[model samples]
Target: MMSKENYEYAKTLYEKWGIDVEEVLGKLRNIPISIHCWQGDDIGGFEVNRQELSGGIDVTGNYPGKATTPEELRSDLEKALSLIPGQHRVNLHAIYAETDGEVVDRDEIEPKHFANWVNWAKEQGLGLDFNPTLFSHEKAEDGLTLSHPNKDIRDFWIRHTIASRKIAEYMGKELGSPTLTNVWIPDGYKDIPSDRLTPRKRLKESLDEVFSVEIDEKYNVDAVESKLFGIGSEAYVVGSHEFYMGYALKNNKLCLLDSGHYHPTEVISNKISSMLLYSDQLALHVSRPVRWDSDHVVILDDELREIGLEIVRNDAIDKVRIGLDFFDASINRVAAWTIGTRNMIKALLYAMLTPNEYLKQLQEEGNFTERLALMEELKTYPFGAIWDHYCDEMGVPVRENWLDEVKEYEETVLSKRK
Candidate 1:
């Protein structure tokens, strides 16, 4: 959290840099924010026992191993919305049920019930973020078998893609807003020296079909490509291979980049530039580091933190929609989310204050050291210290204390996990 005096000092520095704090703040104001929700063992569940939470098993059994009834889930969502400041909206990812090892159809759940939940949220001034996988939760052969050139599997994917688009359209009409559709296909191949060509063609065909239907004059479909390793004996294969973004670009779709999904060694700016070159809408999933796991922890400054924001600023891409795609089954769920959100917001503000012309000049001069110094200076600015600065200046609630509350909550959750 930034002290009021420190914030004033930082504002002075911004003025010194010939940067219009008001103009930069105005641009920052335009970004619309949302979050992803699920009601399952993966993310939308309670963490009572450490073993169950860490072992990927559901012990709390809070929501019957499925999403709670629409009404019940919406209650939790309303609570979440209350915690956020201003007219903050959420993108609810519907939970699908698997009965006797088989996927259940969306029709099994009453449409009226779902619509009622959407209406309730809308009445409370919240938005929806719909996930397509909710409708295509079929349990087919594992990736090892699906990797084979099987027409049945290929057709199944096509049908799933089409069905997902239809569901999004229906939800959009019901919610009376453009539905936020997030597509993360968990299909992949396992073995090495396998025929990647066939799977690639099938995947591309499915994506093309989705693009043809999902996007239009009203709704915007964002394709979130994740980088995952093998699932079992077979290595998972979707868009992990090289040139996957190029394929996505060719299809005329936007790319949602999960920060933790990439290999740690990959250059963030280069990836952002590539996505921009293809005219793809960039969506970010910010998370913390966990060895070989998408642990979705709170952002810490000691780690590779500054570089993440630097890439975003240097790229000068402000239209990017940032989602706090956090998953914390542990006890301090709200605290973890608050801390992560605060850190990310602070980082973004720091990036916004960066001089675009100075960055260009540094690039032209080929002085990497000077460019890094400027970034470091910006990071230390007190106005960039706490996101509450903007809220305070804007006459919103002073929220710097949320960070402290989050830190304490995280400590409690970790102690219980241990």
Candidate 2:
């Protein structure tokens, strides 16, 4: 059947459940998923004095055509964005700063360093997000930053984070969208710490100083990300969930929850509602965790769907800032971004299409059987047809047809990188 025909048929089914298909598509188009730039280069930024990946961050496989320069990374990102539907923001790290081959340390990074990125973003009509590069540096080789025993080390990271927020402020002021500047540091111990309180105390003080600089919230919003455990910090992570949860709640900061940054059994989907109750707004770093925080490409799994459901049902779309965080060098890097981003958007669409109010009524009225049955049946609904129409309307390839373009690009553009 033609796309419009199939869409018309699917629209009827969804409308029966009180879902406005047209409205849903409109809302989905406006929900921008911040696509991370690290995926193109395997977290390897274009630093003049680049360091090896550290702080529990690792990218497997030796994929050819990894973006080696700022221009190449942006070009690869452009290609990926072309294949993906919807206008999205690009999430960047301080390390991705282009300083014209100058050795600009993290602490010294300025908004001018990202002039190219800001200009490109303006041309592409995309928003921008930022993160401070706290790991993979000599000061953080011990896996301690912001909470380092050495005051100088902690001060260095603090300066870097402040600089990052300033850069984000500049992007937001120029782009007319608030830029989320997230801070995730690798600061913990390899073995059992004699005392954890001191490190956390230091971190809290550092954060206070950083936020004291006072960038307007209209331009830049800050978030602090926590981790359960890292390669070197297996025994104890100072910025554990409990620590950051309290800090964020008290300090009025967004506690960024990375899907992969939790224990094996703990799922971030369950935490979204609880976090929203306390924080006016929150952020997410959506990624797939196979066994550990491996940073695999996101798949449309039950958790992803549940996350979408929570966000939609609670009407926290504006309250929650969503960003993708995964890098898989095993597959085509562009394909990785496309797959993960498309899945994230698909998850949101799935949630929007759901009869959430009806489900809530069912649960409230003790209609578990009907609710379960309806949920299961909805899974087999003509969602794929609706998705296809969305792509058709949005002028992007429908279904897996995007893979063909990736293959052609790989052969024509990626293969020639070396």
Candidate 3:
């Protein structure tokens, strides 16, 4: 941990750059990152008679200690949340609703099915967010759901999404916070389709029906997600970025920007500003896209830093909802959550500690030379000392100490899961 004297010295250094070190630390600590629950089980929910994930999504590894039940998943999530720095939220897919070993179809899911989760969140003092599971089912076997040509399939998926919104609202009302239930359909073809426009039309219509019964925005905030392509939907995806961007704009819904949903070269940091301008609110599904939407664990890299900077620099913290979305079963599941969530917090701290006022002024004055030079110089400032101090203040382990807690957890808790 950084010493008190060193922290004060670092504070003075950031003060020179017009940054308030204590204010920055408190703000970063207060901002909550919604930690996705699927990371605990690699998206394999506790559904009985579950089939292998078929519709475009895929998990890469067979690491041990994957949570197989709702209890285990919640336990793992609790362990992960322990090492993270802030009081965070939990994100859930509808497929994760506790069915009590009953065969509940996606379309039949109710708020009662997720009552345990709501209570758990309340007990933990965490907020809840949601997603409708539109993939990996018999109806989705053809690699389509909401946009499927068969009206029956489309209606089924639409009903499921409507029900999901209700469940999200119930959770939110019960927990005294709004739940953001995002809709992302894996509805497209592996090969190039001759009539791509028809499926997109079907998707738009289905979304209209799904949002027709407007739940109170304070209880349930609906967001739409789009993807470039998935494994089976490589040739064309019905819910393209353009499609949902247009939908979100027209319907007055939040647009979800998953960091991994775009091409490798496209970073969401570049899109956050635009998304915030048109939508009443913005939702982010943070992940790392390797060559494609690989769903890799997030790290404290340049793109992550830029994402944090974008949100903070634009003064959109309250307008933007932050969430982590990655499933890495190659390593310890609990550790994966802890590492990714912590890195995300780290990035936000880096952005919070930045002196954006001077940079923005330089740009506005058309002083490109000083702006460029100062940008590079600010990269080497004492960010680590501030981060270390922040972590210490938050009561999370500072430096490499959190990793040891995770390792010890694996040895004591995760290793015996098998």
Candidate 4:
């Protein structure tokens, strides 16, 4: 009763500013964030002959109840999704494929391996996204796969990526929505490389071959993710932002921008508009980086709001694919997913509740003082009430109360896991 009363009062406050609170919530319900499956398992994929987590990727801490199997992972995901409002998609790596204990190598992986996942998504009424895991295998032991000097190594990754696309297509066909198949390779040098051009050349040619076999865009859209540097590739990363940006522009592929992949000073929020101008669509792997690419769980910080503002204000929510890409083993995995995903949704909701057109008009008129003042003042508005109402309306626990549910889950389902 109190929550309902508060929402009514808050709606009146925003109504004075010409912000339709109910309309905003309606739009918010349709925005689907692709929640990452890796968060539940610390990226320890279900490969029969799983190698140690290599590449620049690392998941610190070992909280109890990490999902050890595909069923467990999906169950964890289901719990996380129920707490988060709105429908969402699940992001998967090729490593997560189930092969029935068969030793299916990356290149040999087929759509049948992911049939279970497609079936599961159909039952959940959820969409699926895919990535071809290019690290943590014998082929990528040297921190090189697609850009390896050896043609055979490059060809193997190319075949794996092509197969991944076919699997993504199958997922899209089964689920009735386009599956975003993003390819991110961990190929780079820790020490300064004398010759950077050759590896990049190989990567380009390899990508050319991968995309040469066309699948219907209706079923799947391809994206290439870039990294600035990594644990091994600190000195040189073959798939730098410039490399993939140029490649994506020329080849009609989506350029996936991971928030944690850039220099500490760079923000993915600032790049969304520029990327959209050149390409019809782009994708994002939203992660938090403390100092390096640490992949901490996301929080509703300044940059996050700016990212939401950019997407909402520009009317590019559909054009920019949003997916979470952080995993922390230090805390309960379901709680981590719940926190990060809820924060993302909150950021979007905050953006939508703002009087964006009025602010833009202020900027256009060169009213800097009013613009700054209004922006800062708007921050203190009754945003929490609006958020609480949203959660209630969506059949989710509002605010910090969700934490209690997470604690219950930890005590019951998670604690029982080995």
Model 4 bad stretches (over 4 Å): none
Q: Residues 1-418, candidate 2, lDDT per residue (tens digit)?
A: 2378788999999999999999999999999999999999999898899999999888999889899988899899999999888999999999999989899999999999999999999999999999999999999988999999899999999999999999999999999999999999888898999998999999999999999999999999999999999899999998999998999999899999999999999999999999999999999999999889998999999999999999999999999999999989999999999999999999999999999999999999999999999999999999988888888888888899999999999999899997
Q: Which pairs, if any, clash in model 2? A: none
Question: What TM-score goes with each of the models?
Answer: 0.75, 0.99, 0.98, 0.99
What number of backbone clashes does candidate 4 have, counting pairs of residues 3 or more apart or in separate chains?
A: 0
In the range 1-418, model 4's lDDT, one tens digit per residue, is 2278889998998889899898999999999999999999999899999989999999999999999999999999999999999999999999999999999999999999999999999889899999999999999999999889898998899999999999999999889999999999999999989999999999999999999998999999999999999998899999999999999999999999999999999999999989888999989999999999999999999999999999998989889889999999999999999999999999999999889999999999999999999999989999999999999999998888888988998898999998
- The CA root-mean-square deviation of candidate 4, after full C-alpha superposition on the true structure, stands at 0.9
Question: Between prediction 1 and prediction 2, which has the larger lDDT?
Answer: 2
Regions more than 4 Å wrong, model 3: none
Tell me the lDDT of model 1 at 335.
45
Specify the poorest-scoring 10-residue window by lDDT in model 2.
1-10
Which stretch of 10 consecutive residues in model 1 shows the poorest summed lDDT? Answer: 47-56
- Judging by lDDT, tell me the better candidate of 1 and 4: 4
Query: What TM value does model 2 have?
Result: 0.99
Prediction-by-prediction clash tally:
6, 0, 0, 0
